[model samples]
Target: MNRSSYPYVKTPPIFRCLIKKQQQATEELTYKPRRRRRRKVNNSDFYWWGFPIGTGGYVIIRFLLTIDWDFGSFIIFMGAVAIALISGYLLIRSYYRDFKSEPPPEYIVNKEIRKKAIDAKNKIRKRYLSRPLKDKVKKLLKGKVRTLEPLTPSATVGVSEKQFLAVLQKYFGQRVNFPNGVFSIIGTTFEYTPDIVYQDSYTGLTIDIEIDEPYAGKSKEPHHCNDNDKDRNRDDFFLKRNWVVVRFAEEQVVKYPVACAYYLSKVIYQLSGIRYEVPAEKLPSIPTWDSEESTSMARLLHRETYLKEHGLWQIRIS
Candidate 1:
């Protein structure tokens, strides 16, 4: 009623602060940044600024310190150069925060190439060289060794295994052990034997090479189908024991025996650093087999039809 609010309720300091903050928030919500036009950054200027500070700094430091020019310096210089180049375009990125421009197409392409190269390098390293390759049981006294041994061989050996053994023996020589050579977990009755076992006696590296036939020869029942939980469990068991398991279709082993041997050699080298050279080598692309098609393979074989890479081989289920 026109009275100065009956009594002057001195605004509480917190309330006043809250009101200010709310006003600021409201203003921020409504505010739209106005685009300001500025001269585009020149290519020459950008390039000049792009020189990596780390490399430039290294040069300056070396000059000032009168560091002896030798292999060590060269190595250190290369590292500095790598750091600089990898950090940004041409310059150390952190120092030139003010510079901004759309990277040229060439620069973008080069960047993408570099990223892909790095990813490829990492993939190879992580899978084969670096990272964890396989879980090797360790001895407390000597530390980690990539082997678990005194294997319990499997109960049965398939025909395909014996056939492929001859092929592997050609390349691997005595390194290949004829199978029923599988592993059994300690304190458990579980056991599995691969078709072929390649054990590097010196390094104690073991590889399990298996041939997957779509169905059992006698039973005409589907085996090694994708949905088979037993295969996965068996694989896990061996893998945990630090074994490298390689599976091949029975057809691939029979027809492309030499190629299979060559592939095995390459895999052995990659995993255990053992190298082999095959005289007549021709690697062909083999299609991956899956469970659904394997089921079909089983049905076909039951009808007295040979599977022959039937997981959609050179022909579909007609």
Candidate 2:
């Protein structure tokens, strides 16, 4: 058959050669080994350098020392090294002893510094003390004083509470019963006692004072219910007997003592028809908490109960 007459044609030599080359390349790739990744050396291995150097150095020194015939120059060198090591060790030991035996540098310096500091403080104190009597009185009486006292159930009344009672005695003067000459409220019936009580000689007015601390935000339901309930029961008893109650928080005594005192003074005046003005500058601003009014009422009721129960209302204070 004539090739020209057929539609299909034979492949060219170049095309055949290309096909063979492609097959050979694919076969070569299939048999090739995979490349492995190398692991990195860690920097922490640097610490091992000390062990090798120390062991090798010790071994070399021991070997040299064991030689039967030592060169004179080598002996001199070894002796010098030995003397140097011994001297270094002694110096280190002496430094340690000095550090351990002597007082620290800070302590020595602080002692000297404290002496000068005390001298300066004394001079300032003397200057204030040398001021006029009226000025001195004002300073002593000025800002609210807070006596830091523990609030443990068994702890005694604090210095500030004592001072507050003293102030009340000074102002009221013979109008209240204070068996020890210092105003104090006492009752034999209850395990706990009120802080102070006062009775008017003419009108039969009774007033009770309680110095309280911050509420500390104890919840009313369970934690503080016992103390609160006791107060309520006491107040109710006083109300039944027609006595006035007054309560003062510790913050009121410390931050706004004059205001607290003024309010008490007002209550006294209303009861006894006696009048006094509380210095406006010293009065503390009224507290903004929701419990202030309730606290005031509770204090009044508690005081009334103690006075009525103890027969203090019968005391005539003219």
Candidate 3:
């Protein structure tokens, strides 16, 4: 038998069934359901353009019909314009109500965003509140501690000292060196600590500012012999050391800071070779004893004696 004459083989029944099932699956996949498209709603198209144009048309028609070419016509035109504006506003409101996309549901803010908002609010609050607090701090600091009496008036030494330090920091800035207490002065390590020292950059002069309060303590010993001797010795030590001491009493500084400042400025000017004049109003008044009844009687008696010698005593006495 020739090879060409051999019978052609047919596909198996199982293979034919598999091929039919695949064709059916492909036809089912090709048949897709169409997706419904969302309608596009534009806010400006509906409200800004459409409503205004429609209302404007209505207003123009009404104006042409009612116009009389007089003052009344002008008034009527204005009225129509006003009515059109009101209608346009209502139309815009209605369009927004009917066509506006629903606002997304209210969202709980994230922790970080909420925290940032809180921080911003706190910062604003602090900015306002800090000014008054700073002013209060400045006033408190400007108050002189040395002026306070230990027992007579209520002692505000602690408060005054803190305030004084704050003022010093504010005036001089942070780089200034301040001694901790009186003990720093007496320490043995050759440490140079002045109460209030300012070195002039130009003149190379160091100013040592000292404020003295009246020591009200009563010693059992005599004044000229005991504690007074120690004080005099201290004054001598400072003087011998060539220290320029600017001493002001508690009363002088507390009652008259301007006077204190004037004196201080004068000293600085003199040392620095900078010419300055303190105002007359800023100058401290010379202290004088007020005359009491006891002193007045003594003065009268002395005056009478002088007048009698001049033979003018009787006229004055009468």
Candidate 4:
């Protein structure tokens, strides 16, 4: 307990020296703040200094080397001037080439005019959306009259079925069913209504035509699946009742209306057991005011020409 009473154990001098050296080494290795590297400056001053200085030095050296205005000095000066002139010419030529390559302002003006015409046509079509029977039935019942969204005709021929119907009408006339007609397949508990139905008055033959949208083939969506199943059931029900069901893809109807009508006419003739000939010109073209299916006079001439050259359009639909 008294001061200096306990004896202390001392380490060897070599070990003590080694431990001190280790401590010094550790201190030397300790982390220090890193100095940031200076970034290279991209200054325009260097460019300005180099270009004028280089050019002036070259001109001065050339002048000093030439004692008098000789042919060599004249040749060098003229060469430089020639290069500058050539470069300027090339630049101007490139600019003019680019300017000329662009379409004229009139092209843009014409495109805008065509777009306006299409919009006007669509607006006029909206006036023809009256569903006469549906409206009449609603009025007679005096019940809650329901209004459905109008099927707006597409701007393009390949996107609307109305054009296809117009084509069919041009050839078959009154035989083609359109607009207000709907085929009802009556069941004991329910009923099925399809889009279009055609019945031949002479032969007492009925054909049910159904045009389906492009997305109808996709089986992934829930509503589409349900609709497909319902359609299959309806078709089966009709087939059992001895009804002839004809289905057409909407795209086929839109894109190839002429070919589609020809096929349909052939099939109708076969099913009805009646034979008839339809002139190519008489078949309607899509975009109906196509001069009234592209004009009666144009179509007649077209038919005459087609007949003269191609002989006849014929197909066997079995």
For all candidates in order, the CA lDDT equals 0.56, 0.45, 0.41, 0.45
What TM-score would each prediction reach against the true structure?
A: 0.48, 0.33, 0.29, 0.33
Q: Per-residue lDDT tens digits of candidate 4, residues 1-318?
A: 111211111222322343353334333222232333333434653464445545655665676677688888777766655554555565445445634565558656766776777667555444323323223222322422111123432222222345566777787776665424223434553435544545554443445566544231123112112224565576665554444566664434544567666666666553333555654433232221212322342434432333234322231100
1 or 4, which is superior by TM-score? 1
- What is candidate 1's TM-score against the reference? 0.48
Scored against the true structure, residue 26 in model 4 reaches a CA lDDT of 36
Listed per model in order, the count of residue pairs whose N, CA or C atoms clash below 3 Å is 3, 3, 1, 3
For model 1, what is the error of residue 287's alpha carbon versus the real structure, in angstroms, after optimal superposition?
4.3
lDDT (tens digit, per residue) of candidate 3 on 1-318: 111211111222322343353334333222222333334557755665566567767767877886467887778667767767776677567555633554333312344455676567556655644443223323332422211112222222311123333444444443223433331234553333334544433333334454433321122112111223543344344444433445554334444545555566565453333434544345444221123422443444533443355444344221
Candidate that beats the other on TM-score, 1 or 2, i.e. the better one: 1
Model 4 scores what on Cα lDDT? 0.45
**Better structure of 3 and 4 per lDDT:** 4
Query: What would the per-residue lDDT of candidate 1 be over residues 1-318, giving only the tens digit for each residue?
Result: 111111001221322343353334333122223333344567765465555554566664675576577787777777766665665564344344344666457656766776777667555544532323222211111222234345656456665566568777877888886653345566987766666777766656667777767666666667676566776677666665556677776666666778878777766554444578865566554444456765676666632343344332333322
TM-score of candidate 2 against the unseen true structure: 0.33
> Which model, 1 or 3, shows the larger TM-score?
1
Report clash pairs, candidate 4.
Answer: 290-294, 291-294, 291-295
Point out the worst 10-residue segment of candidate 1 by lDDT: 1-10
**What's the lDDT for residue 87 in model 1?**
50
TM-score order of candidates, top first: 1, 2, 4, 3
| lDDT per residue (tens digit) for residues 141-187 in model 2 | 23322111222233245324555666666666666432222311246
